[model samples]
Target: MTVDVEDYFQVSAFEEHISRGSWDDLPCRVEQNVDRILEIFSDQGVKATFFYLGWVARRYPELVRRTRDEGHEIASHGWSHIRATEQTQEAFRQDVSRTKALLEDVTGDPVQGYRAASYSIGRNNLWALDVLQETGYRYSSSIYPIRHDLYGMPEAPRFAFYPVEGDLLEVPVTTLELAGQKFPCGGGGYFRLFPYHLSRWAIQRINQAEGQPAVFYFHPWEIDPDQPRQQNIGLKTRVRHYLNLKRTESRLKLLLKDFHWDRMDRVFLEPAPSP
Candidate 1:
């Protein structure tokens, strides 16, 4: 399991509605929400990778330290919340490099994983993978294999695979294929949009039937139903962001109990046995 450590206002869906310039002035609830998440994970005895934004780390170093102290993995979610597709290669490099350095400085540990903002590193900009490797990351969970209006690389593999001929791994979020169609089972809006039982069933199928581990993710804002709602967003964005907010924490508890979850590095970056 992974948690995207960003605040609700930083969400890409609200970029148009909420300007980055105004981020500092807005109230931040990420610390409190993450505290709740940490409590849940501790109670369940699960360790997860937290892909934190540099912005959040700079503002809440204690939160990062607390998460690291509790045995969770700290990874980068870029310096700000800019999508990889939106950045030039140099800019993307700077973002990841700076964020990685900042996180490592805060935790005094080597950061080994990255997740692109909004899963924006698709076919057109897969050079981001090379940049990640260049920056010393071992793996990334940045691709969602299913097609969607916002982001996806539908042609990408449904499980962990090297995007290029290199050691750096690209782990796509989980999806269930049926009748040759891929449907997202990974966490995010889909986790809230679908019935909890449906998600449970799909994950079970992926585990038992396909013999593959599922890569699940959700944001810190997801469980905060009372977060300040954005105004003037279209009905679609409104529903996608706000639907079933109350159910996320409860459902997440069920998911933790229902399956075995570990840090992304532990689950996917384990060193191969030497011959």
Candidate 2:
């Protein structure tokens, strides 16, 4: 299991609704939401990877330290949450390096995993893998294998693979091909938008038929239905961002009981890769 540690306002969906300069002025709700998530995980006896935003970590070091104190893996979500496709190689390196340094300083552990904002690492910018390896990330769950307008390398491997030939493991978010169509089974808006049974069945199919564990992800903001509704976003963006917010926490609880979950490193990186 993994939670992207960012506030409701920090998401790429709200980029047009809010600016980076004004982020501090908005009510910072991530701490409360994450605290609730941590509580839920503790109740469920589950540990997870939290992909921390460098901007969030800087403002909420205590929150980052608390997650580490509770034994969750702390990983980088990049500084400012910029998309890899939007960043040049040097810019990407600087972002990851800075976030790694900050997260390591906060948690005092190696920040081994990364997931780009909006999963922006795609076919054209494959060089991001080399930058990740060069900067010392052990694994990345940044690619979505399904086709998407914003981000995906649809032709990428569904399971974990060595994108740079031995260093960083690229663990694409799980998906399943059924009825001659691909659907996203990995958690996010997809989890909320689709019936829980469909997700459950799809994940079961991947596990039983494909013999691979699915990597599920969600954000703390997802559980916060009462967060300020971002105004002025386009209808499509609004629905994708706001759909089923209240159900997220309960759905997550069911997911925790339904399948096995662990940090990205433990789930995909260790135990040796298949030949």
Candidate 3:
């Protein structure tokens, strides 16, 4: 299992609705929600990777430390949640460097993983993988193979592959193929929008039929239904963000009990299991 350790306000969905200038003044709730997540993982005897934003780490060093102390892998979600497609290569490099340094400093371990904000490292910005490689990251889960409005590389490999030859491993989010089209089954809204049985079936298909591990992801705020919702956001964004918030935690509990999950590094970085 994996959790993006960012609050509801920092999400890309509300980037336009809520300005970064007003971020510090907002009510902080990631700590409490993440605590609940840790407790859930603890109860299930599961370990997960938490890809956190650098800005949050600066304010909540104790939260980062607490996550590390709980034995979960600490990874980067960029310095300010900036999408790679919106930044130049040099800018992306600087962002990754800053985030990697901050995460390593906070955890006292080599930060080996990265998941781009909004999965924005798509075809136009595959160079982001090169930047990640040069910045010393071992793997990234930034690209989603299915097509989407904000981000995707639909024709990309569904399972783990090295996008930059040998420098970095690109573990695109999980997808299920049907009628020759790739569908988004990785997690996030798809997990919320669809029935639990659908996600369960997709992962089972990936494991049994495709013979690969599923890389599912969710956010800390997903389990927090009462989180302050922004009113000025677009109707589409509001619906996608707010739909099924109350059901997430319960579904996650069932997901954990049903499947064996581990950090991205261990699952992809390690040798492939014999087919």
Candidate 1 per-residue lDDT, tens place, 1-275, comes to 99999999999998999999999999999999999999999999999999999999999999999999999999999989999999999999999999999999999999999999999999999999999999899899898888899899888989888887678888899999999889999989999998899999999999999988899999989999999988889999999999999999999999999999999888887762111
Highest-scoring model, TM-score = 1
Task: Encode model 2's per-residue lDDT on 1-275: one tens digit a residue.
Answer: 88989898888877877888998898989999999999999988888999999999999999999999998899999999888988999999999999999999987888899989999998899899889999999899898988887788888888888887766788888999877666789999999999899989999999999999888899999999999987778999999999999898899999889887777777776775863
Cα lDDT tens digits for candidate 3, 158-230: 8888777665788878999999999988789999999999999999999999988898899999999999878
State every prediction's TM-score relative to the real structure.
0.98, 0.97, 0.97
Against the hidden true structure, what lDDT does model 1 obtain?
Answer: 0.94
Worst 10 residues of 2 by lDDT: 266-275
TM-score of 2: 0.97
State candidate 3's TM-score: 0.97
Q: After superposition, how far is residue 56 of candidate 2 from its true place, in Å?
A: 0.8
Flag the better candidate by TM-score, 1 or 2. 1
Ranking by lDDT: 1, 2, 3
Clashing pairs in 1: none
> Which regions of candidate 2 are displaced past 4 Å?
none
Q: Local distance difference test, per candidate?
A: 0.94, 0.89, 0.89
Ranking by TM-score: 1, 2, 3
User: How accurate locally is residue 191 in candidate 2, as Cα lDDT from 0 to 100?
Assistant: 98
Judging by lDDT against the true structure, name the best candidate. Answer: 1
